[model samples]
Target chain A: MIKQLFRSCIFLLVLNAALSSCSNNGVVKESSTADKMGRFPEKGDMIMLTDRPPQLETPLNIFQQDITPNDYFFVRWHLSQILTKIDIDTFRLYIGGAVDKPIAISMKDLKSKYPADSVIALAICSGNSRSTFSPRVPSGQWGNGAMGNAKWKGVKLKTILEAAGIKKGAIEVTFQGMDKGPLPDIPVFVKSLSIDHALDGEVLIAYEMNGQDIPMLNGYPLKLVVPGWYATYWVGSLNTIKVLTDTFKGFWMTKAYQVVNNAEANESPDSPAKVTVPVSHIKLNSIFILPEPHQPVAYGQPCHVEGLAFNDGTGIKKVEVSVDSGKNWMETTLNPEISKYSWRRWKYEWVPKTIGINHLMVRATDNNGFTQTSKQWNRGGYAKGFIEQLDVKVK
Target chain B: MLKKTQFIFIATLCCLFLVLHSCTQQKQPDIAKPADENPNTFTVKGSVREIFINHDEPDFPEAEGKEIFTSTCTMCHTLRYISIQPNFPHKTWEAEVNKMITKFHAPIDSVRAGKIVNYLVTIKGVKQ
Candidate 1:
């Protein structure tokens, strides 16, 4: 017991030091002794992005392992009040609106009626790295951890639409989750996608994640898995899927999560907020794996600089690493995975010959000739695709 | 003999630290406290059913507007939503405050909302 207490003492000291630095910058406050008692069962390194509606972020280091673990999957919800206890037996997904007829399909019937399929795909928040935006936009101040990849098992969304019997003039499909707000004035959290995007055969109304029933926190029972797209459209605890003839103008799609409609999708904060487009498709982005931001390296020792690169549907064609503060870059070897929708891991070995602070940069190019830009600017901080810089010191 | 004494002193210090840390952890949820000063009473530690809102020590810059800001805004969400953001201009804060009223239906009246906006602008807004 004494030895165990001694270990705990050392932990407290280290945590105190970490807390001092973090609390000041508001990186993460050291949860007081009181804070510790109330913390939910979360991965030690996972971060609480926000409390109400409960958004969580995965630590970037965990991404080094391909196929992020299911428990560590980031959680996000638009509504503060959620259905905690769901009776799967009685729970039926309602499909209606602009269809031949509205049908309430039971969970068992929905699965047994259609063949099940699995795909490893990434689900990223449109505002995944909103905190990094300058002139800081205020929403979920998340880092890169607001994204995850999972092998989702479910029936094709097209199959469900077919069962509902789509009529002519149905242009888009709107989705509503089992989350609600307290007041009637507060709009229902709903999002819609173009009918073509909805029926692409890849969209899965997922029941299981990583070969098991999805966790309640990460959208249990059912979730809309739109591979290669941002998670805003991938509604959690999804219960309602409605087809529409007109474009969706819900608060979620119209007034929020919008990027400037220009090609670059950037605008000054002072600029007129006009002509916006719904955030779609994951952009060509990359992140550092070994020697994370502010980490150190040894001079004259060989070390591999590794990271991951991903884009919406267009597969990653090239990923280049820069040693000289992004002055120039060289290509890295890509480790391809089974699914094209997943992020590809890249590696490049380098022997640090110079001493002092060194900057490492990474940029990726997707198959569609879309390469990352040096800077990405927007008010909403949606779909940021800027080249990443990792500063390290040679000791 | 001097080295032995030094080791004993270090051991005693560690033990004291352990006790202090355990006290802070306060494993059992205290059910009895109801005083306004007791933050624990506001947030019982043990229930998932409960929604507890806690703030960091020295959460924000102290000013006259903080009291109003805390009581009104935090009813729906945590103050960290505002504190965590990088400082923007009053133009941004004005739109944000208006958005709270118009979009989220924040209960603060126009006058109180204006005061809240002024507070945000003065404290966390762009430095003049």
Candidate 2:
């Protein structure tokens, strides 16, 4: 009888252990969905979300509010797989190049020395319109959600440069990120900027994005936030800082990231021009998020035509919505609380009076009087400002 | 003796109940077929044909392409971006590939570019 009791206890223990293992196995299987979607950073995986389209369906009108939640912010990384951990204390920012004093400032010092300032600026991809090009550009074929508005909290770039004492003859200020990955034989990923632009009070070495510490995918410890500049100028995992006495040349600065004018007279492999200098400010662009692609909407019903708009740094002067192609247009009311660097939300209440396919178009103009047009196109597919027109079947 | 037997009997019964409960709770390997499952798996005759007609060739030899794509293509986007696009003519495809080298700074070249474009056009391109 005693032996039987002992055997019974052992059996129960074994059963419990088996059940626990099975449950763990089930969890492992479920977690693979994100991995399969390529969201998980693995050995040999590039850290940039640019490595693939985001798993979430991109929301139209990315500028609905001032603060873009970390999860929703469109991610762009040049190199390094997703950073899982960042230690802020030990992290140091190196500021050098044509400076009276090249200095390395720790995270703690950066906060203590300068009065913290926040700015709202649009960070857009230079190749945001790669898909619309005659020959589809090969990159993340982002359908308009690649840009977002976030209120960045940090000390101004000029504040840091002034402390270091900007020297004369500094043609360009190059920034290198701590972000590292296997680049064939190369060991690092870096980008640079002109000294004039670096001294702009708006250029920031930001510690916080949208009122919080930036998430790992969005450059956690620190990142350069060049307001109104394309993301290529915004270097992540920034580690090396150099002041170039001559023109800065690297894979990113020179051979790659240039807008080669195949049609221009001087267009050649050796003489390609970098698209880094801010060209035309961000042209007016908007997207309809509520009625998603191919979703049905009822005819003769009140529908909210909602989206976001921005005029780069100039600020939006006006936004217009057209329900009948471009034949008719109406002014859209802007959301007042939107951040300056973030996108401005706009809405026009529309009742589709007719029952056919309604082509809806949206356009905007900045304070500088630069209006949105459908004719802009570049070889690299940069700055595609064509009006967003959505086709919906009205029942 | 009788008391001991009863105790043993109760303990055995409890153990049996636990064993049965655990077996029942074990997640059965999904018996239901997912809506998108394709049951028919077959080997393709050749790489080009498989890519062209079946639209099912790995972008590169599984080992080489995956590494190159991860290093180069992923600098800016995921593999699905390539997989999701409707295939285009070679000329249009070349222009698209060059845009990465030129605009977004993707680290691909004529040789790798040719391989990637061939694989995409064969497998992912919309049939003309």
Candidate 3:
């Protein structure tokens, strides 16, 4: 709602200030979101960042279960024109180009052809915590709720590629969905993955999320699930799968959703790094489950300070919690996981002795040895896996 | 070493940052949050056929030049895009206005665009 209001604000000012700036068409070098209005509704406890094509985010506590509820799952669609209803009887999945033989398989044929395979994985937008960027980024000023973990049930993408018969020289596989933008000038939402990545067993064409036909906003008929990768690569409302012979250069892939092509995938807003790359596997991060910021904890009482930590499927090795503004640190206990790709739930016990504002923080290290940082800032507002700090008032 | 006024300015800025950038807004207890379903089999229920998102009207509905803004600028997108952001300064608003006109090819002519920018700077932008 606030975004629309900004859209209509007449051009009322002339460029007049001398502020530090980024090179993105002379936009000032701040990544902070200018959030005047609060959350808009996306459905079932989820808040929408944008309304037209419906981009939604889950609340922090929605992480109550490692497996997010299907009804509350967040939805994101780049295109404005989405097919609300599908004629399942006539729906066909067309697999064409760079294959031994082009094939169009119906929903029924897909179900009967391959046994359903399932995996629990997180689908995260690359800009999950974009709003928290200090200087403020221009769009999608979202908090961390832009991600969700779910048990997705579908056939492995490898199954379909195998049935199509591998033809040599195929380099990538492209996917298109049933949604489109308002104008033809706006590019179609198409994304392509490397052929090797496509054939990887981790990729799935999920028709069901958390034991139900995927919600309409969450992609009704199908979604391409790339475990550990950002949701941009996870094509929603999947329709066509086209194999390619060369590296894919689609706008969604080549242009948008890229991070600084560096080891840390981070760069400065004032001076951007050269050579950007598509934002790939998520970085390690943790969040507070209990004692939410400003939530009151009883003084001199036992309290469970808890939250979830996750990586791009690499297991969380250790989680450390600090209650006195990182003055004293304690190791948190992590619950045994049901799925490797899912987040690990962690908890720490705190007995607050004093009554005041108590800062609680949690940091995690993944098996990959990537430790969470105190602050993570990127130019396009992406991949912030900083240690989460919450201020709890112990009364 | 910063001057006293400079310290206050920076401190105010920091406080503002904390207020605007804090993760998770005030909790709403009444929102009905659903629980996770069994991660196994499935049965179809009701479906979402279509969505017509009802956006809120602009905050400055009664402000000057609101008519020109709604008539011209609401063509491509709703007003939510602008309203959702933090308070932008005059220059940022100018750049943003110019961006929409030059980059996005928004149909607002220079005169109207200038008026819109003026209104934004006067009402929504940082006070000089």
Please name the candidate that would achieve the greatest TM-score relative to the true structure: 1
Candidate 1 at residue B68, lDDT? Answer: 86
By lDDT, the better pick of 1 and 3 is 1
Residue A365 in model 2: lDDT: 81
**Segments in model 1 whose C-alpha atoms lie over 4 Å from true places:** A1-45, A270-273, B1-61
Candidate 3, residues B1-128, lDDT tens digits: the string is: 66786667556655654553332223212221122321212233343234334443334535777777766656656565665577667777787788666645566788898788777766667754
- The top-ranked prediction according to lDDT is 1
Q: Please give the TM-score for the first chain of candidate 2.
A: 0.79
Number of the top DockQ candidate: 1
Distance from true location, Cα of A206 in model 3, Å: 0.5
Off by over 4 Å in 2: A1-58, A61-63, A80-82, A132-135, A184-188, A260-280, A337-339, B1-78, B92-117, B125-128
Comparing 1 with 2 on TM-score, the higher-scoring candidate is 1
Error of 2 at A37 (Å): 6.3
DockQ of 3: 0.06
Native contacts recovered, each model: 0.15, 0.10, 0.10
lDDT (Cα, tens digit) per residue for candidate 1, span A38-118: 232322335665556566788788888888887688878766676566667778899999889799988889789888988
**Model 2, span A287-369: residue lDDT tens:** 66656668778888888778777655668877898888899889988877355666777888888877879898889887777
